[model samples]
Target: MDANREIQAPNSGCKHGGWVTLPFITGAVVGLTLAGVGWTANLIVYLIGEFNLNSIDAAQVFNVVNGGSFVFPIVGAIIADSFLGCFSVISIFSCISLLGTVCVALTATLSSLRPTACNGGSGSSCNHDHPSSVQFLVLYGGITLASLGQGGTRFTLATMGANQFEKPQQQGVFFNWYFITQYAAYVVGATALVYIQDNLSWGLGFGICVAANFLGLVSFLSGNRFYLHDKPRGSPFMDIGRVIVAAFRKRNFPLSSMPDDYYNPITQAAPPKKAFRFLNRAALKVEGDIRSDGSIAKPWRLCTLQQVEDLKTLFRIFPLWSSSIFLGTTIAMQASLTVLQALNMDRRLGRHFKIPAGSILVIQILTSAIFLTLVDRFFSPAWQKVTKKSPSPLQRIGIGHGLNLLGMAVSALVESERLKTVHDQPEPTPIAPMSALWLVPQLSLVGIGESFHYPGQVALYYEEFPASLRSTSTATISLIIGIAFYLSTAIIDLLRRVTRWLPDSINNGRLDNVYWVLTVVAVLNFGYYLACAKHYKYQNVEKEAAYDTCD
Candidate 1:
């Protein structure tokens, strides 16, 4: 057999043959679309200045527009797991995202047409700002629609992509390539977006996004035939109930350990119910279960409360995971606020060169790729040989967070240097813009931390949950992340309020203080995560052969 055919044989449940090309194509297209969205969003801030808006108003507008993405993933996950299957969910959402892209482009076009449509009056309070309430009503509607699609796209596509490769050994390589490609998109998208926003109009920037999203949609739709469609199991509510009922019966049923009638359906005659007295045992409390005599029968005996509590043990570990939201938010800043920070940096690469700040994102992307490749190819195997035990994903999380904390510390040092440079150098041309090179160490550290943390965290959440609650579990992780964003903002706000005594030179528009705050937060988060890691007892799902996975 050829390599492709060999890989497909083991994954009997997944349809891998004719559909292999579909996933790779879709992944690339999706990458382009996401890059496009990011580029357009960043361009809006620059475009807003053309409307005569002041710094604060412009910042608020940008925050509101970007922050709109926070809660939309929940909606996407709900629809995907419940009503629409993953494929349909992706299609519908991708299409809606394209609509949002169009709206963004139109908003820029319309602002040029009638700035009055933003605000009612003048002096930066114009009625026709980028998508006013009427426009916002339209814009937000599109955003909401697109968010639903985009949020679930990663979760579903990654899973579907993995499904395309079936061989046990190939699965590892498949996921490795999958993550590598996704991050590759992040790098390409970030780089391309930086270039586009610097050179193009906001309308063109967003118009490009629209095209990219449409391409993603096309790639997904075309591969519909090759995907293995696993119908989602029924609602957890019913399944949970069934499990409880069965557990209770197993405990309380008077059937005892007596050999239950064993029939070989292929060879034996059907045994009469009367053959086994245990069938009438009173302990079997299965509701509505009936006997052949039209009499009330039960499923089995009742389970002890202690038995139920045994299953409930997983709930205890949740608080530890949930509390990490604070950490998630701080880490997320690498994507959100870090971009803003880069934008504010002295972008002049040297005396004669001016590079876009967003280009710094490439540093992050490349670092992640290099580290991930190293871990899979070198580090993981080396560790396995030395310890005679593979590193658990949870173990990796603790280590990842430590690196993340160190990365934050490096960022603080970089910021301090920048602050020192601005204070000491009075000249307009201060010796090659204070060496923008300092940011490399910090950005590279963050990239390494990302490689350690993100993929492992994703796998951790899914693997830790009972199969029935995978969606709910993953959603919980997302919720923590969303909550973290709010918490990070709150912490920064609180710190700003407390530091109000500082002079503008040290405080205003300078993120040096913010770096310190993040540094402190990361240290505390890392410590907390380590403590949780020590106590966490990973579930051994492989050992539980007969247990119902229905929540």
Candidate 2:
């Protein structure tokens, strides 16, 4: 038997789900990511250029928007797994995204919706047209709705794609492919769409985003007849609550040694493992715990062995998940800082071409996209050949941690160089003479690190999670990113209030110190992750050796 065939494929006799579903899934992911990233990629630029916000203010708004986009997925995932299912959730949100992009486009087209354009210069001399409170409300409304749409579809789409495969190895490979498509879309959006928004018209660029969103929805809906719709098993959160309540109620019941003392499935009647023995009380089969028909009689007094085990699994995984939050926080901070760095640095490629400040992040996106294929194709196979076993998810995450630390160090060195050049000047210059290409090395390393850890975390969560909570499993990543981004905002705000590291004018601020701080944070977080990975145990017994995986 194939070891990686972990889950029994549901409703196998039905004709849906297989390689045939790949094209539609791929199309949906590509179109949605393309449109979603188009606007998102140039957001700081838009808020600064179109909305007349200063650099620090724009970064703050960007973090909040980014955080919300990621945070909403948990709710969307719960609703899907509980009632609507992935198809419905994706469909509804795609339209919402389309509506949002259209509204944002309106802000670009209708001059009345925006503040009057500022004369191009700094300070009171430029006489900037500050957005009225009413104008800010209209603009924020569009961005908020778009973020909600983004939050709804992003991780849920990954869950839906993974569901199309039967083997655990295949599911792992699908996640890799999905991210490649996603990053490719990001590259295009950052480069081409940003060029349009910066060079041509914001309205036209946003119009293109709306069109792409619509097309993505169309492709996703076109595949409905071919999809294997997984029915919801009700809210898993309610079951989680039940487990806690039942265990507390039976806190005083003395544990029994007999095989029949606990609830078990008919064929799988083996006794529960001894880990977290306190939770085992929930599954204890007391005299009145079961009804005459064998159903659970007291909802809050008794739970199945599986429910107890599921809660225990979460308890074990939470520490590792918590470690990842700071990792994300550092990365989010870097993303914002990189844009600010590029804005101040020399962005020229040659005599004829100049790089867009916002589009510079595409280097990071492209590196991730290119290396995903390489890591999936060559790296894992080589590791398996040398070690006589495939690399596990924790091992991959450890490598990512090391690379992230190195990237932060490089970023600090680069910023120190850029600042030295600025200080050498007798007076403050609008832009540094140092080429923006200096930023690429750090971005690429961070990108490579993402190629390793992001997919590893996804596969690890999905493989280790209880079957009843699969959709929510992937959504957990969104939750981490969401919290990290919001925390980053708070950190930045605090820095501004107390220190001079992130001044409104980044050129005057100690940008290098910020990178140094993130490096220290990454170092401490990496140590924490190593401790967690060292003690953690793998839950999934399924291990298919046939396919090459990102791990």
TM-score of each: 0.73, 0.90
Candidate 2 vs. true structure, TM-score: 0.90
* lDDT score of residue 275 within candidate 1: 26
Question: How would you encode candidate 1's per-residue C-alpha lDDT over 1-551 as one tens digit per residue?
Answer: 01211122324554544347556445544554463455434543443334434333343443443343444556655565556655676677666676766766666566643244323212244423443457546555555555545565655565455555556466556656666666656665555665665666656655666777777777777766666543444333343444355544454444433322221222333332332233223323344554566343442333222222323544545656764675676665544445444544576755866666556657777887889778878887887788666666666666677777777777777766766666665663222245556677777887787777766776676666555565455555666666665565555556557765222222234566667777787888777776776666556755223222211
- Top lDDT prediction, candidate number: 2
What C-alpha lDDT do the candidate models reach, one value each? Answer: 0.55, 0.83
lDDT of 2 by residue, 444-493 (tens): 99989988988889878887788777657778888999999999999889
- Model 2 regions lying over 4 Å from their true place: 1-21, 121-128, 162-177, 252-259, 265-274, 540-551
TM-score of predicted structure 1: 0.73
